[model samples]
Target: EAAVTQSPRNKVAVTGGKVTLSCNQTNNHNNMYWYRQDTGHGLRLIHYSYGAGSTEKGDIPDGYKASRPSQENFSLILELATPSQTSVYFCASGDLGGPNQDTQYFGPGTRLLVL
Candidate 1:
């Protein structure tokens, strides 16, 4: 089956540090997204890109950034990582299969821990 995967499945960071989560999708989809899964709010969109060389900040853009240099790769950058930012991050790639329906194939996830 087609899938999305993340690297450094687990991470530990100091109070003021930098962390980057990598993602790669092989499905050849046109859109890529980054999200954080946390309690209470569930999943929240942090960033997304359409095709290659284009990225947009999603709902929550504070303390985070994103890059989409090509169709198959997208990266999430945390300039100044903080403890509150610790959470499970996910990446997804997808395309609209039907009218008003966009199917996003998600990566397993990257777990991050901040001190």
Candidate 2:
């Protein structure tokens, strides 16, 4: 099974403050993704990476940044956090091929509150 973990299960940040959310995957998947879950919007993609040293913008990448330092680590960076950016963030890992292709394994989630 693919295992994914996120840091600082819960967080509180001030407006304009810098916040970083980290994720790690035990399975050596080729793709990693960062998403935010909001009440009515569902899970919206913030950023993703095909592999290490590469990052790509997703659906809602306006105020976030992503880093994939290795096959097992991915980080989400918020240079200037705002209340509007507060939400539950999730990280996922998956591969491109096999029977379970495109199937993502998600982390527990990180709740952020920007005041």
Predict model 2's lDDT versus the native: 0.96
Candidate 2 on 11-115: residue-level lDDT in tens? Answer: 999999999999999988999999999999999999999999999999999999999999999999999999999899999999999998999999999999999
Off by over 4 Å in 2: none
* Candidate 1 Cα lDDT to native: 0.90
- Clashing pairs for model 2 are none
Q: Mind sharing the TM-score for model 1?
A: 0.93
Query: In model 1, which regions exceed 4 Å deviation?
Result: 97-101
lDDT of 1 by residue, 1-115 (tens): 6479788789999877888888998988889999999999999999999888998989998999898888899999998999999999999998866542598889999999999
